[model samples]
Target: MTIIRTIPENEAVGEVAEIYADDVESLGYVPTHTKAMAMNPAAYGAFQALIRSVAKPLGLRRYELVTLAAARGTRSQHCRLAHGAKSLKLFDEEQLERIARDYTGAGLTDAEVEMMRFAEQVGRDAATMTEADSQRLRDAGFTDQEIVDIAIAASARVYYGSALQALAVDVDTPPTLGEPLRAALVDGL
Candidate 1:
């Protein structure tokens, strides 16, 4: 249960309803985060746009990877589950589980591992970064723009994940989202 109310997709009104409609169009169901963000659709949309902008440079898969790592670093149950389920599109249960358990041994590519580390570092302590950190990303084959995108995605998790966890926002029911994925998300949570 959550202190914050999670407005249902059908019950949403005004701009929030519009966003919920769009979410259903894209994802087949409104996500928990979307329901929570419905408190202010304009700001929520802006944040989504920012995430999209970040993903444009980093790509969706990389963005999801960063999100998973950032969420795990922050111990955001909703995020870990949501992102773990999303990553299922690119990775298998074994892979996602391995990643959730330990990214270093998850058999990810060096580049992906580096990005994961970057996300964790960004979520844990961005203030501790130095030029060498950027250089490491460069060595991992990421352009400066891509690195910035990684930072943005991870930072977004820090912001949104913190709020969601602090408010104890409850995730949506699994029925509409179907099997396996629902199981994955809930179990991962």
Candidate 2:
């Protein structure tokens, strides 16, 4: 359980109420992370906007891949489970399990593998990154814009994921994710 107190769904009002409503409508239940972030609605909105901006250009498939890699690197099981479940839209259970186990050996293309590698680096330590990282993506045929989007996507995850970890928020497992894949994501390869 998290140490911070957050607005309860029943007592929510204004933007927080709307955010909770949207989550209930979409996810059938309010996510714990939502409650934690909703402690400040403005910051939560800004975070959502940033996530939307990152996801738009990369599209959902690539976006989820980068998110998963970053979440893994951050050691954020909450994000790993969330993004891993979202990844099911792009890959079957078996394939997703393979990815969660070892994305490099998950039959991804060179470009995709490189993209994930870069995201992992971003989540792990962006300060340590050098031009060689971007150059690798360039060699993998990613445009400068795509590269920028990838970096932001991963960095954004680092921000949110790290915050969630700091707060010690409980992980919310998606009901759709099977046990094997969930274990792979939560327990690592």
Candidate 3:
């Protein structure tokens, strides 16, 4: 049972309306993930803010890279499917499949794999992190600030993914995008 009602795209108002409009224009639909957050405008807005705050500092690829790993680590198909769709824009089918099955086996560059490993750890147990963790990222060429940003991005995904899952928000529908990855999104769903 859904613990919170999702706001229909057309019925959304104010911030939700604006956000929904952007989603529809860019992705073709209001993602179920977004709709779930729309149940509480404040929470939805906060999610948006958190994302924007990291946009420049983390950049899209790195941020999504960490996020996808964390999503998989958390066993959240909702997040995995969504972030997996976004990742398809940058990576090939085989690479994405590897990431889906196991990032370490994906043949990603050492730096990329290291980032995913860090994100997975953050998702699994942040308490386990130590100087060695920072050293690993440093060895991989990530600066202290970048490491913090990666951690923040990975940690933030838990909020929406868990909430949507707990609220039983749907993820069966694929996001709207065109070209090479459109089918990939469907496959992810």
Which candidate leads the pack in lDDT? 2
Model 2 has an lDDT value of 0.91
RMSD of each: 2.9, 1.1, 3.3
As for TM-score, the candidate ahead, 1 or 3, is: 3
Instruction: Score candidate 1 by lDDT.
Output: 0.78
Candidate 3 RMSD to the real structure: 3.3
Best by TM-score: 2
List the candidates' TM-scores in order. Answer: 0.85, 0.96, 0.86
Model 3 lDDT per residue over 23-108, tens place: 78877777877777776778778877887787578878788888887776566777877777677678776677766666777778
Q: Which ten residues in a row have the lowest lDDT in candidate 1?
A: 173-182
| Residue lDDT tens for model 1, 67-159 | 988886676767777676667688877777767777888899999999988888887788898888878889999987898888889999988
| Model 1 regions lying over 4 Å from their true place | 6-8, 172-189
Could you give candidate 2's per-residue lDDT for residues 1-189 as a string of tens digits? Answer: 899988889999999999999988877878899899999999999999998998998999899999999987898998998888778889998988888888999989989999999999898889999999999999999999999999999999999999998999988998888899899998872
Q: Residue 158 CA error for candidate 3 (Å)?
A: 1.6
In model 1, the clashing pairs are none
Error of 1 at 166 (Å): 2.3
- For candidate 2, list the clashing residue pairs, or say none: none
Please give the ranking of all candidate structures by TM-score, highest first, separated by commas: 2, 3, 1
